[model samples]
Target: MEIHKKFAHSILLLFVVLATSQYSCQAQNSPQDYVDAHNAARAQVQVGPIAWDDNVAAFAQSYANQRIGDCNLVHSGNKQYGENIAWGTDLTGQAAVDMWVSEKPNYDYSSNSCVGGSQCLHYTQVVWRNSVRLGCASVQCSNGSWFVTCNYDPPGNYIDQRPY
Candidate 1:
């Protein structure tokens, strides 16, 4: 009886773990997921939180949908919006945002530049004070990789301006 109870408990625990992992993975790609990830990073630097815009999301979704064939990392060329893009196998929207936020260490707020010329534009854009809106999209490509993108309004990363 004791052995049976222990086996049942183990099976239950494993089931719970698997269920939780699956749900989290599925939840990582929504618009709210993207906004929450971005806001969390922005909050760390005392920057104001941004809101979601349907128009912006539509634009992002359209661009992401277009890349379903090749999953290439190309800018939308809108110039009206700031953009950050990422591509990887099994990439999720939250994962892409996390990857961008990982560049925080490379950014120098005092110097207003990336240290050693490392790529920190994505990080800077996430925390840009004047960028009051955000939209993001994730699409699975024909090659089995994922493409993710986030667009910011009023843009960021001006030639001589500080992000915050």
Candidate 2:
């Protein structure tokens, strides 16, 4: 009986450790988190890095806040800045940026287009060489999903211009 109890306690402790590790692996939604992820992705394509902008972030935050009720992936309709929006369960800033970067394989620099009608705007916007400012925000909605948005100054996805 004593050996059985010890084995059970060890198993429980192992499970707890594993659970905590998994939770901690999830990224947080911080401004720096967003910037770091974006910079890393941009570096891969030799594009210049972008700095955080308070005004841009404020705009992003306001837009993100507005979606707390529905967490919809709607644009703010502001033409002055380039934008990207994402919705998911417990989404983090870094995770959202990673999701955008994942589209890299679909983007063809020579053609300056996404392959086979696939979506690559988000990826292009991230590494847009001329987009020097970036602001982002993330909010957890009433329905428990997360909404994330990032805005870029001088937006990237132009009709005939390449992102890099």
Candidate 3:
């Protein structure tokens, strides 16, 4: 009898935890917002020689701060924006907010050159293209809010490929 009671209590606790987690996910988040956060975060964490999924959902929640629960993906305060990573497409905010290197084009892997020479270029392209199923968020309500800034490593482009 004692074992049965313990099992019941354990199950009850598990149920409560699941319910609370789901409620938390919905309370402060919308579907699009969740998708955005997951994608962006996945990119950031993915480059560190390790692949992670646990933090993806949490990373996607911040976009909820800018959106309303309406199905149209509009936000109550459209003044704010969310940015995503290169391979992310969950539509958290606008493409303008992303922390990408603007000087390079998004069409190819050259925009995001790889480390230790261009060997990673082809591989990066494949990975990037394959991971773009999330699609883009088509809104930029945070117009002119960001102070555009850029930094380039002068001596870094030591390769022989230059338009002379």
Candidate 4:
């Protein structure tokens, strides 16, 4: 009986160790997680060799911000003037026309040049309340300062028809 108990105990210990090791190994850190950790550590001391994912995300965000800023410039305030009227406090027939005209030019990317390997362009259009799409007002780069045009039909077609 004593020998049997010892063998059982050893088997249990071995199982526990194996399970723990498997769990730890399966909980690998993602690329984004590594980037965040490295950036946080760099706040205290200089770190070398930044991850590629971090660079790509940063570049994408910067390009998006630039496009949004430009559109907001003409549509921030005074709805009846520029692109703001579509989703602003005013929605006149003339305002709708102006919106379409604004979207017809380079504001829509029909022929984008940023379609390559690691240096491709991605666009995120403005959507309202998880529904109505506000269309694309600009194209942004994920790794460089390259951009294209973007827009949708009927210009600023908002299903909710409200600007928040």
Query: Candidates ranked by lDDT, best first?
Result: 1, 2, 3, 4
lDDT tens digits, residue span 1-164, model 2: 99999999999999999898546534566778888999999999888789999999999999999999999889999998999999898687888899999999999988888999999999999999999999999888999888999999978788999888
Residue-level lDDT of model 1, residues 1-164, one tens digit each, is 99999999999999999998656655798878888999999999899999998888889999999999999999889898999999998688999999999999999989888999899999999999999998888888999788998999979989889887
Give every collision pair in model 1. none
Alpha-carbon error at 86 in model 4, in Å?
Answer: 50
Q: Estimate every model's Cα lDDT from 0 to 1.
A: 0.91, 0.89, 0.33, 0.32
Rank the candidate models, highest TM-score first.
Answer: 1, 2, 4, 3
Residues 1-164 of candidate 3: C-alpha lDDT, one tens digit per residue: 99999999999999999998655533423335434543453355352111223233333334432332222333223112122322222322323223342322322334445444423321232223223333222222243121211111111222333211
TM-score of 4: 0.24
* Stretches of candidate 1 exceeding 4 Å from the true structure: 1-24
Error of 3 at 40 (Å): 21
* Candidate 4 local lDDT, 37-87, one digit each (tens): 323433332323233233333443343356542322223222221122222
Models, CA RMSD each: 4.3, 3.9, 14.3, 20.6
Between candidates 3 and 4, the one scoring higher on TM-score is 4
TM-score of 3: 0.23
Which clashing pairs does model 4 show?
A: 107-150, 108-149, 108-150, 109-149
Identify the candidate with maximal lDDT: 1
C-alpha lDDT of candidate 2 relative to the true structure: 0.89
